[model samples]
Structures are given as structure tokens and as C-alpha cells.
Target: MKNKLAIIGGGASGLIAAIAAARNNPSLPVTLFERNTRVGKKILVTGNGRCNLTNTDLTEYHYHGEDVGFVSVALSSFGLEKTLEFFADIGLLTKAEGNEIYPYSLQAGTVLDLLRAECDKRSVEILCDQYITSLKKINNQFIINDIAFDSVIVACGGKASPHLGTDGSSYQLLTDFGHTLTELYPVITQIKTETDYVKQLKGIKIEAVAEIVAANLTRTCIGEVLFTEYGLSGPAILDLSRIAATNTQNSPVIHIDTMPEYSRDEITAILTKKANKQNGTLEELLTGILNKRLGQVLLKYAGFDLKYEISLLSYKEIKKISAAIKQFSFKVTGVKGFQNAPVTAGGIRTKDFNNTTMESKLCPGLYATGEILDIDGDCGGWNLQWAWSSGYLAGKSAAEKLKNGDKND
Candidate 1:
């Protein structure tokens, strides 16, 4: 009898794993199980529905995990070039914006449709609404809800977006197989600060540099920073929020540079000139330079009354205002949690799985991949890249092992 392969979770990694396994071994039967009503439900929401396919900067530097270097083998096996080619072969055209890549149609649905089409042509059986809760290993063959399979691959993702079908429930199955998990944290989420000033500046959006100092590691990102009632959100904050989420013990602090284009000295000189001319009240001094409300808040935070005349401001006061603008710091209390997080930071420890094959070192014929494996990437399409890379490696390796008739350890 021919071997059968079972893949749990029909997310990005599971879908790609089924395709790779079925495509590599035509005779092998591959079944993909999804808890959701359909597969790729999470794909529809990525990149704001545009579906960021991959990134040009596909390096190990962007990925984080217990053993971040473990990704090198899988990435080297199937990198961006192969990913693009595979998508193209399945009839999906792609476009690139700077370092990020997306579907030419600019619709995430298009990408999902193409992947499903490829799986269909490869005869990969897709079973939806199969909420697999546990697996049994009897005589080296895995049993999923009483169904026997020669090999099993778990790609059920993490707890980042619980509503999207990956609620991190499948982690228990791996733990049942003698695997361990690392401390989990939500990443790519907004930062909740301990300040009342942000509440007054709510709804204000500005291009600024956001820097977070945590665990003695400093990370900075320059983009749009949106002041929310809860705290801060936007591209810049989300990019650096990982550090804050992971380093809660070290007391993370985020500093925003409202005017990145101007140095502290330049801002001081400009403010001094305006004050020397007696341009307007302290409230009106930064009207043209910043949002009126944001400027007012900054001045107030620097201990200046809005009714105070700019001409009465001393050199020391001017320096203080400039310092506030250049380094507006806030104490980071926490993040928005997994519900708002784009991806989870920690997961199953990578040491238990072979990086080249993504197979379990403890349990032969069992494997884990994607966000569930403790390897998460930065915001720029790197997570999906890892899913594809690791999934491809796991599927291909599983198929090869079965083909070789390798006895289970």
C-alpha cells in the first residue's frame, strides 16, 4: 500500500506543504485539514487585502526565534526566486513595491485562488471544518481522529489572530508528542503607553521616527505614527513594537522624533528666530511646523503655558522644546495583545525540529512548520516567506522519506 501524508491547518504553510508533498510524489496521497470553514481565511487579510507575497530583503536578520539561524537551511532550499516562480507557474502575476512584493492584481483573493488551483491540479485532498484536536501514534503510524497516516505535518500557525482560525490550539498536539514550547508573546502590535498626553493627541497622524529601547537593545523605524487614545499605532510603531513585547522586564521606553528632518540645533535656531521676531504666542510658534494640537501638547509637556508669548521664552526654554520634539519619550506599559497582533513572536522551540526538513527530532514522521515553530519574521512579508520555505522543506522531506521507505525511528 502507498503512504498517506496528513497536513493539519490549511493556512499559508499547510496549503503550500500539501502542494509540495503532492507535487513531489505523485503516488502519495496528501490530505490537508483546516478547522475553518475554508482554507486561506487568514490570507484574505494580509497586507490590507493586497497580500504581501514576499520581500526582497529575505535575510536571516529579519527573522526572530530561539535559533534564528535555523531558518538559513530552509531559506536556502527554497528562497524568494523559487517562491516567485512557483506562484507564476500557478498563474499569479506579482508586483514589487520597494522591498515588499505583492500580487499584480493587488487582491489577496487572487493569490489564494491561484494556490488553491495548483493544489487542485496536484490532487491534494482538502478537508475543511475538520477541527483536529489530537493525534495518536500507533506503531510508528500517526492517527488523526482515527484516520491513519504514514506521516503528519502540523502548520496551524500561532495565536496572533485568534479569529482568523489560528487560535494556537494545535500547540497541544505537538506537546503531546514530547515537544516543548518557548515563552509566547504577541508581536507587530500597537504599544500601550503610560501617558495622558497621547490621549489628547489622539487621531493625529505624522511621519516620525519611532525608537524603542528595551533590554539594552535599541530598534528604530521611520514611518507614519498615529496617536491613538490607547497609545500609539501605525507602521513605525508596529515595526518596533516587537522589542517592547519581548522585553517587558527591562522596562521598554519608546521615543518619537516628531521632526526627523531637522536636528535639535536646527530646531532650536528656528524657534529662537521666531521668538526674536515675536512671531506669535507659544501656541502658534509650531503651527506651520507641526499639527496644531500636537505642537500644543508638546509645549505643555515641556512646562510652557499656551498663553505665554514666544518672545518671552528664554534660550533654556527654547532648548527644552527642541529636546521634547527630538526625543519625546513615553513609558511602554504593554502591547495590544494577540487579538491585534499581526504575528506571534514566540512558539514551539525550534531545537526539537530539524531545520532542513522541519521534522520532529523526537518523533519521526511528525513535523511542524510556520509560525507554530517559534520562527516569526518582521512585518514586511517575512512571516509568509518562512511559512513557504519551511513548509516546502517539510513537505518535500516527508515525501522523500516515505519514498525511500525509511523506517520510523
Candidate 2:
């Protein structure tokens, strides 16, 4: 086992990395260590169990990092097309919803099963419920709890969703080797606000453009944004959470454009028509236009009495209503934190590793991939794609070095 490869974390990246290494080298041993009771635990719950495997729209805009270009090599090596081909080769057919990709079976378990079966076929050993306490390289031997391997891949993920086995304790492993990590924060998560609108409008779903108005940047995403007791949660909101996390040092502002399709004049015309055609009250004017509770909250947010007839509302009031519809602002208190965050915003700095191979510049024979790296993608399927790409490079790169016996050059 002296030439064997050890991969920490049996999550998305770790599993794929192990498979990639074992399949390429064949004889070189590749073993994965997962602290959870089972591998792919987080994969099972992704995209609400459908498992968003990849996205149709793959671009730099979907990702965030201090150096976003660090992912170029890995991504270019194995992109979305390669990802689909790999999945198809593994016998897991996929279907696309708009740009988002998922298993044709519509079950995350299907994807997981296929991945696990493929890894098994490749002679990859999966050790679950195996917590690696300490990681160190001694006498050219990569050691985890005294067990040694020729190369090690760190894919233990970040401090998001501790229940899924990313307890953040694994970060110490890299820091122990003198790796520099950026300030970690919960991103791709829910945003808490100071407005009572979400509370009164709870359980209502509205299609809107959720915006994060930060110190110097204003990012927006258009999708279904759900109102909750605490704040906003949904696809659009989750995407904007990255901006929120990056600007958390200062109080950020959230603006939701509920009626992105309409202009201010259009809203004014529509409201006037509703008043003249049906003698509609304020609530009635927005009856079909918005969710009932959402309309009322917007009315209140615009400083209108709900019972007032739309006909009685002055032009000034109408303009305010239009502004409220177009720009419902919420003062962001903070993010939902790591426990509730789907992914983390920051991690091991990208400059510390080679993007093409994911090998740590600080520590030779050691590689980092997936959520452990600084690269994080927005909600959709970018994150999973990152896992697959980086994992592939890490495993393949590590295995090649192990086989040729020319590692860390």
C-alpha cells in the first residue's frame, strides 16, 4: 500500500476523485474516507433530492472567488459535456430542466447508486464512518492517523451543513500543513431581513428579481423567491446570498423586483384600468397581479391603507405603489449561518494550489478540491460540476504521479 492514494471525504468530489484515480492507474490502490455513516449523504439531499448534477449555462458569472480564474484548467479539462458523457457512460441517464441537469429517474439516489457502482467497479475502496483525526506527511509518506499513502487528496468540504459531515474540523488538516484559508462564511444560503413584510407574507411564493445591494455591487437573480417568517429563501435568493456573504462586513440591502416585466408607467396604467373597469379596491387591483398577502404587504410597504379604493389613490400614491412593486427593499441582517447554508463562500485560498492539477503549492503530494477550495458556484448545478471537475483532476493527477514515480515536480 506504499504507492496507494488516500482521499479524505467520500462526498461528491472525494468519491469521483477516488474513482478517477483507480480507473486510470488500475493497480494503484485508491481509498476514500468518509466521516459519515454513508458516502454521498449530501448528494442525496441536493436539489431537493433530484440532484442538480450540472447546468446548461456554464460561465464565469455563475462562480465567485478571489481568483475565479483558478478553476479554468479543471473546468476546461472536464466540462458540462464531459460531465454528461461520464454520467451516461455510468448508465445514469439525465434530463434537463431549462439549464439545470438531473437524473432522468428524478431521484438523487439513482445518481448516487450509479456513482457508487462505478467506483466499486474501478476497485475504489470506500471507508465510511472513518474520521481522520490528523493528516501529515512523514518520510515521503502521507499519513492519516498513522496510516500512510503516497499521495492525499483533501475533499472534506467546508463548514456548511455539519449534519452532512462537514463539521469544519477537517480544515485544521490543511492549516496544520501551513495552508492559508480565507475567512469562511455561509453562502448559497437564506438571507434574514429586518422587514415585517416577509413575516406577514409568509408561505407565499413570488417570481421576482432578488437583488443584493452591497457596498459597491448590486447582484440580482430572477426566480421564485419564497417569503418566510425570518426572511427570504428560494433559488433566486440563494444565488444572491453569495453577494450578501461577501459584503457582510457592512450592512447590505436587499431589493426584490416583484414586477420585473412591467415598467412604472405600465403598472400605473394597469392599476388605473383595474379601478375604472371593475371599481377595484387596492387589494382587488392586485388580486390577480400578485399573491393576496404579498399585495397587501406591498400596499403597506407603499404606505397605503388596504381598504382604500384604487380609484381614490392619487397619482403620487400610485407612483409609490409602482416603486414598491419594482423595488421592495429589505435591510439584510445576516445570512442563515453554516448549519443552514447549502455551501460555503470561502475556503483554502486558490493561489495556494495549482488550478490545472489541484496540487497544493505549499505541500507537494497533497491536493485540494471541491468545496474545500476557494472556488464556489451559485445555486443551480455549478457547485456539483466543480466537484466533478476538480475531483477528476485531483485523482487523475495524483494517480499519474504515483504510477510514473515523478510526483511533486
Candidate 3:
């Protein structure tokens, strides 16, 4: 007799688990439940519709957790090599742009469609709009939505993006089943600033470096900086926002180096040479060096006379301008919240599940995978890779356990 399996949540993790379990046990009955009308809602929005499937170089260091060793085991079992092969086997050609990997077709919809078609070919039952209100262990069967299954895999995602179907509701469901959950927060989102300069610099973008200065820890990232009406955003600012979101509450201060490639001394040397040779106004001289709007804003902040001749500018004034450009600081009031975050920072505690099989330690015949676990990766393709690897392990493990009639207890 074939074992029956149920996977909850039809997002990336849930869909992957359904396909993996069905593929592993062809004779077994596999059914996937999704709260939304369709599956892969979040997967459709990844990488601005390109879907960064996985990273070429995956390591435990990209994730945040108490037990680093556990993630190491999961990564080692299904790392970048396995992930590449899995996607390629599914008929999706992958290409690497720097460290991030995207489909050769460069369409997120292609990845989602391929996965959906594969599930259909395997004859896996996909139940849409079937929200699992609760789960109960009666006799030896796990009951969900009044349907009994030999084993259940909870691939429901975390609280990061609600519109995509993972709104942290799975946390409450798993907790009811005696699973431990961690404090939930937003990750890979923009930060709000308390300073008024943000308004003046709104919509201005420049290539710069942002540094987060906590009590004892400081981290820096160099990329494009976007000045939003609320505060700062863009890839570089989003990366630093994680540190501020985790450590500071009220409002953390971040220093932005408008020019990271050149030192203050080097900039000053160029400025001195240009100012000595040209009789142009300060604003005109600065226009060639920085954005017109940004240069004006910086000059206003530094209390410099923009209309003055470049040759007449004092040494003290130049030093002040140079310092502001090197150490321009702003206060980060808060993050944009989970609705705008790319991924949830926390979820089910790792200690509550077996690292090898993703089986719940407290509840037998019940397993958790994907974002439901406390493990989360950075902005690139780490989270999706986690979904594929963890979901595959849980689906295969649960199917094997049910096939052998093994006692989960």
C-alpha cells in the first residue's frame, strides 16, 4: 500500500515539497494545499520577475541562527551543486550573473510554470483555496481540513510578504501543535529616516557606500543609494537595514559615503586644482563632481556659500565639505514592515526539529520546512535555495517514514 502525504501552503516551499514527495514515491498519494487561489505567488515576484533561483556559492554564513552547525548540515546535503542539477533536470536552463543565478530565459514566470507543469505531470493533487485552519493527531493519522493523511509536511512560509500568502499564520498553527517559534521580524526592506534632508534629497540616486555603526559592530556596503521620500532605499541601503532592524529600535544612525572610491585627501587635491584654474562659481564647480541637486543639498547642509567663486573658497570651508561627503550621517527611524520585506527574519526554532529529516521533535508524523523554520538567508537567492533543499528533505523523509511504517515517536 502507498502512503498518503499532505503538504500545506502552495508557495515555493510547498510546491517544491509536493513535487519532491510525489517523485520519490510514485505510487504514494500526494496532495498540496494552498490558502491562495494559486500557487507560487511569491515566486512570481522574486528578482523583479526574473526569479533568482539559487546562488552559485551557498554557505552557512549567509544565514542567521543560534545553531550554525544545523544549517551547515542542510547546506552540505543540498548545496549549490545539487540545486543547479535539480533545476536543470526540471528543464530550466540557469545562468549566473555574478553570485546570483537566474533562469536563462530570464523570466520568473518560466520557473513557476515549469514547477507547476512538473507537479501536474506527476499526478500530484493540488488543492487551491483550501486553507488549513488547524491540524490534529488522531490515532496515528494527521487530520487537516477533515482529511486524514499518514504524514504531513508544513511548508507554509513566514510573515515577510502577506500578499504572497506567507503572512506568519503558519506560526500560530505550528505552535498549536507544540512547535516552538521564534520572534518574527522583517528582513530585506527599506529604512525610514528622521532627518529633513531626506525630503530635499528625495528621488536622488548615486553610487555610494553606507556604513552601520552599532555599539561595537560596524558594517559597510557599496552600491547604488536611493533617496526616498521617507528615507533611504536601494540594494545597498536594504542590506544595511537588516543590521539596524535587528539591533536598534528607536532610530539608528547610518553614515553614507557619497564617494567611496576616492579618499577625502584625493578629492581635496582635485578640488584645489580645479578651483585654482577655474573662475567658475562654487555650484558650477561642484556640478561636474556630483549630482546638481545632491551637490546643492550638501552645500546647504555644510553652510557653504554656493554662489561664491571657487578660487575664493577658504581651506576650512573645503575641509568641512570634504568631511560631510565622507561622513554624511542620517537617522534610521524604522523599517517598511513585513508587507514590503523580501523575507521574514525568523520563524520555527531550529532545536524543535531534527536537522537530518526536518521532522518535528515534539510531534511525530508532523514535519516543518522552508520559512516556517527560523532559518533565513540574505537578499540574493539564499532563501529560495533553502526552500528547495529543506522541502525536498522533508518530503522525502516523510514519505520514507510512512512507507516503512516507522514509529516517529
Q: By summed lDDT, which 10 consecutive residues of candidate 3 come out lowest?
A: 65-74
Candidates in order, TM-scores: namely: 0.99, 0.95, 0.96
Model 1, 30-94: lDDT tens per residue? 99999999999999999999999799999999999999999999898999999999899889899
Q: lDDT of candidate 1? A: 0.92
Question: Which candidate has the top score in lDDT?
Answer: 1
Rank by lDDT (best first): 1, 2, 3
lDDT, candidate 3, 1-409, per-residue tens: 4568999888787787788788777878999999999989889989999999888778886787656456776677777887788788889998999999999999999999989998998888999998887988888788888888888889889998888887787787789877777777798799887757878889999999998776776778888889989999998887777677887753568899998888998878777777777886777767778888888888777777778778888777787788888888888777889989988877888888888988888888788888888888887898898898888888778877876778656
Worst 10 residues of 1 by lDDT: 274-283
Candidate 2 wrong stretches, greater than 4 Å: 277-283, 307-311, 407-409
| Candidate 3 residue runs with Cα over 4 Å from true position | 249-251
| Whole-model Cα lDDT of every candidate shown, in order | 0.92, 0.88, 0.83
lDDT of 1 at 233: 95
Worst 10 residues of 2 by lDDT: 272-281
- Best-to-worst ranking by TM-score: 1, 3, 2
The pairs that clash in candidate 1 are: none
